[model samples]
Target: MNHDHHMKITLEAILPSHAARPVKCASCRTMLYTTQNDSGLCETCDEKHLNTLNFWTAAQKWEELVEMNRWFIRGDTTTAPYHIGRLWEETDPLIAQLLELHEYGFITIDSQPEMEHVSLSIAKKWHLIKQRAYLTCVLPTRHSLIPISKIDGLRTNLLARKDLLVTTYCDNTTYPTPKGQGLQDAIPLTPEYKHFTDVEKRIYTFRSTADKDKDVLTKWWEAKTRLELKQGRGKFTESRTFWANNTSRITKKGSILTGPDDGDFQAAAAMRPLVFHIAAREWDAGMEVVGMLVKMCKDMGFEKTFEKFEVELED
Candidate 1:
């Protein structure tokens, strides 16, 4: 799997706090802040490539950790490139990535392997190959997908610990994820810690910001007109409709997301309103997409379609 190349991490450096400023996006004039990558993309535009950037950023650390541990040395050892070793128990972000690589078959094993452990050199080599790949295939679009060193660094810290979800939140900014006890959280449940005594002090924070658009769209969907039901702009964000791709809008028809080919998108842009049957997910590479009842009914509104399928216990 392309063992001849080295992984290069061209991710941008972290900008100091003093250098921070809120500037307009060069392309769209949306607010661009220093908290993001030093480049020009706006927060909304930049978030689109976060998954891609995060993957490569993790790869860089994997390379560093493997190198620092002296697991494999190029041209120094007569051993073959693929070095089989017992899988590490450490859940360090880099080591976790190594485990992920083994899960995905990048790290191979012998025929009579014990518990099917990882191949160290192969995993490290994969780290190299992916970094090289990012440079060629992904780095060219750096303006759109520039790396945010601050966030990357923070995530590495959180993921290093096998279990550290969140500590605190900025007042009401975080999403109100349901408690395991009840909907009102009267008996606040904690997924992190268990109660052995009368009191088990635990905190489960919903750090992610609630999607503001959902509130607006929900209001619009509740009492939309027949015309609005046929054609209304309840949601503007394409990111909500598809997982990792907005281009799938072209393939869907008669659904809340009509075909991109049938003048549906342009009509919404020029004179018509747009309505999307929204479904959102947080996932990365190698995850599967399962649609329970994605089938569309043209007579039904987006709100009804959503209520029919792909829901959590509370949704």
Candidate 2:
């Protein structure tokens, strides 16, 4: 994912003037002649209302104010309006309010990652106002992947996994579905979709390599265990067998599956000692499972610790 950014302004152009120049107050239709940029406020409003410092600071205070409202019922509680208004509001009243806020220096507009037409319109209005108005825009920071190294106590079993991490979009909504089912299922395998939609499932492969040690295995198990605690493990299976056609048909002596009467199933079975194994079925679940692998590796002091860990975050 990509994010667009923009700055809001109302004036067509701003020309610098000496500090002694006079300007009309954004509110009350009062002439603010003879006032410098430092004291642009009229005497009447200064005593009754907050000036630039208070107004701007109040708007800034809304920065981390993610909650819009809250409700409780049936012994459960929830909040709403994680975000207010779409990128912009379409109605004239809404536009008027936004402009009013701008005039009073209550809010600063920006365009970035996204410049919604509604938001752009607000910026245009700001531009039309004071050319030298103090303005700043902050783009939201995006995290692309979760850092699994920071988590602890991961564990996993053939059918279950844990320690998986997921990224979130919009400040306050539950991820929509389980993560990491194959393309055939409703969920997506790509991390982008995984984070955006809040899909929870095991998508990455998890298994032990010869280089891993007991401590590494322990940590991996702990992480997996945590995942199981949070999200119950969902399971699925895949089966395969290998065998040679015929020894005569097997022109190559070294070909295990190519020997005479060597059925395909037996041949495939011969390739790996562990056969008919089941593991976590979803990407999110798989991550939990892999967390165990990573933890174990770290505990054992493996040189290439955390090499197998995978996490998904919003773009």
**Residue pairs whose backbone atoms clash in candidate 1:** 232-274, 233-274
For model 2, the superposed segments whose C-alpha errors exceed 4 Å read 1-27, 30-38, 47-52, 55-137, 142-315
TM-score of each: 0.17, 0.16
* Candidate 2 per-residue lDDT over residues 144-228, each given as its tens digit: 1222221111212322333211111111112233334321222222222244322122222122211111111101111123344
List CA RMSD, all candidates. 26.9, 27.5
**lDDT tens string, model 1, 1-315?**
122444332222211112236765432343345544444544543442332232222332222222212221221211112221222232222333332322211111111101111122422321100100000000010111222232233323332332211111111111223424222122222233243122112112222221212211111121123343335422322221111112222223322212223222221122111111121122222211111111121112112211111111110
Location of the lowest summed lDDT over 10 successive residues in candidate 2: 66-75
* lDDT against true structure, model 1: 0.22
